[model samples]
Target: MDSLIFALNAVMPIVVMVAIGYAIKRAGFMNDTVTRAVNKMVFRFFLPAMLFLNIYEISDLADIQFGYIIYGAVATILMFLISLPLVILYTKHQDRRGPLLQSTFRSNNALIGVPLAEALCGSAGVVAAALLSAIVIPLYNVLAVISLSLFSGNGGRPNVKKMLMDILKNPLIQSIALALAILGVRVLFVKMDISFRLSDMTILFKVLRYLSNLATPMALLALGAQFEFSAIKELRREIIFGTAARTVVWPLISLGIAYFFFRDTFTAAQFAVLISIFATPVAVSSVPMTQEMGGDVGLAGQLVVWSTLISSLSIFFSCFILRLVGIFG
Candidate 1:
């Protein structure tokens, strides 16, 4: 019951915020142009700030368990590889492929995963999830850029050079890389007994925090404003497929493998972090990203909405079953 409540609590605010955005849109507060601009701002600015901070705030890089990180990264890449062919075969529409592919592997880890981790395994889980994020989130963005660019309508033949360039120019990727470089410098500073750190620059950090804070809510609002009820019928197949893959199949495979294979090797908190990564909903950021990248935004938005709704049950069952089996006690 606590797990169920925690699941609901983690998910409801996102639903409510999206509903509020839809309400305001219905009341004539937002239009297509404004929503498009909001998505652009989110993709280019707010989200990058959020990603940077997520990486930069890791207390110590040396403490990370690379084995856990390697598993998470490998799992993510395998999901992407597994989903790519499936998505291509599932949909004939060029623009729909990227977003559908993204829905399979990229989760709302930063927004939901950390808190869910804490709920499952306390502060230790939070630390594990955060450390995982330092790797997984950047990988998510890198792959998203690739997938979205590859399928963004190039006569069904992707321009490999342009795709590579897009990955390089991706704001999310750039921010994450910069954060890692700074983190490396900070580590060196610590070794040298230097006290300087980016956090010490209070005003700049505060500005970044302000942007970081805006990323989720504002993106949800933009998603809501552009969300169309009629599109649900048009996108019903994609929505159902994406949601089921994200909230059900992906978790079952990832968590099942972890349980049956690595039970003795991984800590409970590590399992919790895996749950946070694989069991969560499709990321809200996918909407903005799809919109920016010319993927089917309607389908992207629907996937986010439907997956988020379904993932509550997924999360609850995952926790309950894992606990029942003595995996998360």
Candidate 2:
């Protein structure tokens, strides 16, 4: 009950905000053009700012949990490889393949993971999720770029060089890379006993803070505006498969394996980090990425809606069960 309440407390505000967006759209305040512009801005600017701030704010390099970072990064890659074959086997619909493949492994970690982790383990869990994001979020963007490009199915073939360029040019990936580099420099400064701090740059940090604050809510509102209940029936098969992979199958396999095999090895907060990565919903970024990269935008949006709706229960059950088994202790 406690875990369930905590999960709800953490998740319901996002849900309600989404609902409000839906209501505004239904009332004709927003149109497709407006939604598209907002999504593009969110994708190109706000999301990247959010990713950068989260990664840059980590206190110290030596304080980071490299074991958890390696585990999380490796797990993300393995899941992408594993999902490629599974999605290929599941459907040959060119449109379905790309979105479904991405929905399987690319999570809403940037928006959803941190708060959920904090709910589960307070500040410790938040720290773990942040460090986890330093690795996992960039991996997600790279995989998203690759997956959408390969299965794009516009004609004869995708341009490999262009796809590679897209991956490198992705704002989110650029943000993560920049943040990592700066953090490394900061660490070196610490080693040399040089005075360096983010606070030294006040205006830039404030701008990033404002942009970061805009990212999640704008994305959620845009998601709400763009979501179509009618699209559910249109992409029922893809939606079901993607949502199930995100909200059920992955969590059970990953968390269950950790529970039985490495139970004593992970700290409680590390376990929470794992759950945040595994149990979170399909990303809102996928919808925009699909649009930008020429994939099934409708199916991608449907996947986000269903995945987000169902993931609340998935996360609750994961925490409940893990707590019951003493993982949260």
Candidate 3:
């Protein structure tokens, strides 16, 4: 009952917040321009700040189990590979392949994973989810961008140099770098107290802390705002496939691998959190990435909405199943 309540408390409010975005947008309180601008602020500035602060606050990087991160990375790559086969064998729309794979495997770990973990498992879960985000962001972005651009018959291939440069410039990537740097310093000089004399560091800390706190609500709202009934109607097939792959197929695969292979190794909470991360739909921001890469933005948006709407069940069920298996019992 406690777990059920935790799930409801964490998920219900996020769903409502998203609905609020859609409602506000529909009511003309926030125009498209304003919506987009606010999203940028949230994404480029606020979200990165939040990630940096969370990662930086932890003095010990060595304790972060790289095994799980490696497991997640391998599973993500495997899912991507699985998509390639499906795209070639099943998908008739060659152009849709990139966007489909992107939605299917890449998760909204930062927006959905963190808050849900915090709600269900407290700060440790939040920190674990954050580490996953730090690993995933760059991998997902570069691969998705390149794949989408290549398949969409775009004018040219995505330049590797440009992509790397963009990754370097990305605020999330910057935060990850800073966080790792702090971790590195800590690991190198054990028991050494790290302090900063730079005035800029203090300002960055304050700004990031505030933004990090806002991340959960703002991201959920943005996710909700992007929901469109018309998009759902237009891209029904993509929506179904994307949502299924995200909220069901992906989590099942992750759980199977973690349980049967790494049985009794990962704690119940960790496994549950990982599966929950996989269960999350595509991020709200994937719309723009789709648009830029010649993929179908409408389809991406529809998938995000559909998958997110359905994920509560997937997460709850995964946890229930784990409990049955005596993992969480």
Candidate 4:
């Protein structure tokens, strides 16, 4: 009962926020243009600020467990590799293939996962999820660019050079890189016995905190506002497959492996990180990427909506079961 309540406490707020957003949209307070603008702001400014601050605030980088980091990266790549052939077999339409392949692995790690981690395991889990984000976000974007480009239906090959450029230009990746660079410099300052740090800039730090705080709520609202329910009949088959692959198959495989093999090795907080990575919904960004890359944008949107709705239950069960097994006390 305790674990059940704990899981509900963590998951319900997210569901409620999304529901509120959907309600606001239904009431005509927001429209397509507003939703797009909100999304762009969250992606370009708010989310990056949040990530940078989370990483920069970590007192000791050396204390972080690299094993989980490596596992996350490896697991992500494996998902991509395993998903490619499966998605190919599932769909012959090149445009559909790209979004479907992406749905299998890419998660809403930044907006949903970070906050969910904080909810599950407090500050420690947030740091774990943030660190994982530094690696996973870049990998997600790189693979997305490649997958979408490969199946773009352009009849020409993917432009490797452009893909590389896009990855470098990604704002999330850029923020993470900057945070790491600053962290390295802070280490050097420590060696020299310097006392000053970025956090000493009180006004700037507070401003950043404000921006960081806006990321999750505003992103959720935009996601809800953009959610549509009209295409279900037309895309039922693809939606069912993509949603199951994202919310069910991937989480069961990834979390099950972590539980059976690495349970004693990783802390409950670490397990929270795993749940955040694998059990979250498909990324809201996938919709835009699919559109930009000439994939079936409708399918991508539907997958995001359906997976998010289902992941509420999936994540709750994950937390409840893990807690029951003594992963959390």
Candidate 5:
């Protein structure tokens, strides 16, 4: 019962916000164009602002839990490596091969992960998730490019140039860079015998705080607006395989290893970060990337919708398991 409450408390807010977005869209208050624009704003601007402020508030990088970063990076690469061959083995439809592979490895860590971190562990959890962004975001993007580029055109070689360019232009990476620059400036200020931190009165603080507060709600709303179910009947196989792999099989294996084998090594917050990595839904970005790269856009969208729909149950069960074992206090 305690674990159920904790899991529900952590997950329901996100689900409710998404429901509100769906309701608003169904009522015609916001159309596809408007909802899409909001999604873009949340991804490119609001979410980055949220991440920057979260990381920038940290006093020193030394205090960050590096194990969480390492754990997330390792888990991501393994998922990518393991899932690719398995997806190829399972599917004869090459159009869906890339999207299926992409969905298997790429979870919605930014929109869903950060909020989950905040819910379970508060500010400390946010910082752990933020630190993880530095390692996993770039890894996910590079792998996304690789996955799509490989099957984009008769399975030609991956475009390393495009991958590099995409990494450079990633808004999350850009935000992290800006935050690191700010951290450096803070260090310089310390050496110069001056003290400054973002305060409530400062315009930058006020603006960024407002934007940060909006990131999750806007993201969940945009997710709701984009949700679709009509294609489910046709793409049943992709939906089942993708949702199962993304939300169930992979998480169970990885989390079991982390819990039983590495229990003594990673902290509870670190375990929570791992949960975000392994438990969240397939990333929404996979849908657009699949379309742009000439894959099966229908299958990709279905994967996103179905995975997002059931990921909450996965997350709740994962949290319950961890709490039952006393991994979280």
Candidate 6:
């Protein structure tokens, strides 16, 4: 009951926000233009604020367990590699490979992983996952962008250096770097007091926290607003592969392998959390990014929607099963 409550406390707000976005779109309050703008603001501003604030408060990075990072990164990379062969086998049209790859491996980790970490593993979990994310995001982006270019038949090979530069210049990356610098400097030389509650600070931090919290909902709502059930049905092959690989096969593969390395420090619940995080379908932003890279927006959009809609079940079940096995600590 306690864990159940915690899960609901963490997850319900995002679900409600998604419903609100869906409702707003239905009522015509949101259109493509507004959605795009809001997405940019949330992605560029609010999300980074949230990430920096979280990382800034992390006092003990050493306790985060380096093995988790190694295991998690390796697990993610392995999953990406595994998905490629399956992509060639399942998807014949070479064009579909790019979008399918994105849908397969790039997870909505920011929106889903963070909250679950906070709820279940406490601050340590958030800190660990946040650290893992710093490594994951840039890697995911490079692979995703390259796959997007290839599968879209956009003849030019993605310039690795350019992609790295863009990833480094990304606002979120800048914020994470700043936060880490603060954390490192504080750990080394300064003895700062955590005497002030965030509330004790000016309303600025307060507003920042609230606004940062808004990222998940805003992202989810934007996703809901773009949902297209008909398109998902139309592109049944892509949808099936995307949904199956993300929600089932890849996650299981990740957990099975990750557990081998992280068995001692990471509980079954933690493994469950990792599985759930990776199990989430495509990132909602994949649509725009795919289109930007010349992939099929309609198919990408449909896959994102279908993945998000089905993820709730996959995540809940994976968590529940892991709990039953006493693996999730």
Which candidate ranks first by lDDT, i.e. highest? 1
- Which stretches of candidate 4 lie above 4 Å from their native place? 112-127, 285-298
lDDT of 6 by residue, 1-329 (tens): 65555555545565666678778988999998887777677667777787677667655556555666677677777777787778878877666778888888888776677777666666656666677776676556666765665555534355566666655666666777877776677666544643443445778778888878876667677766766656655679888888888887877777666655556787544564575457666776565566555666667766776676667666766666666766765
Candidate 1: stretches off by over 4 Å: none
The candidate, 4 or 5, that scores higher on TM-score is 4
Show pairs that collide, candidate 6.
268-327, 268-328, 269-327, 269-328, 269-329
**Candidate 1 versus the native: TM-score?**
0.98
Q: Total clashing residue pairs per candidate? A: 0, 0, 1, 0, 0, 5
Give the Å shift of residue 84 in candidate 3: 3.3
Best by TM-score: 1
Tens-digit lDDT track of model 4 for 122-188? 9888788878877788788788877887776665366778767867776766877888889889989
Candidate achieving higher lDDT, 3 or 4: 4
Ranking by TM-score: 1, 2, 4, 3, 5, 6
Give per-model TM-scores: 0.98, 0.95, 0.83, 0.85, 0.81, 0.78
Clash count in backbone of candidate 5? 0
Q: List the residue pairs that clash in candidate 4.
A: none
Model 3 over residues 96-150: C-alpha lDDT tens digits? 6778778877787756677776665677776677777667765676566555655
lDDT by residue (40-130, candidate 5, tens digit) is 7876778778768766876545676576577678878898899888888888777888899999889888666777777777877777777
What lDDT is obtained when candidate 3 is compared to the true structure?
A: 0.68
Candidate 5 CA-lDDT value: 0.76
* Candidate 4 lDDT score at position 116: 75
Task: State the C-alpha lDDT per candidate.
Answer: 0.92, 0.85, 0.68, 0.80, 0.76, 0.68
Candidate 1 structure quality by residue, lDDT tens digits, 210-310: 99999999999998898899898888888888999999999999999989989898899999999999999999888888887888998999999999999
Worst 10 residues of 5 by lDDT: 2-11
Q: Quote the lDDT for 74 in model 6.
A: 75
Of models 4 and 5, which has the larger lDDT? Answer: 4
Q: Ten consecutive residues with minimal summed lDDT in candidate 1?
A: 60-69
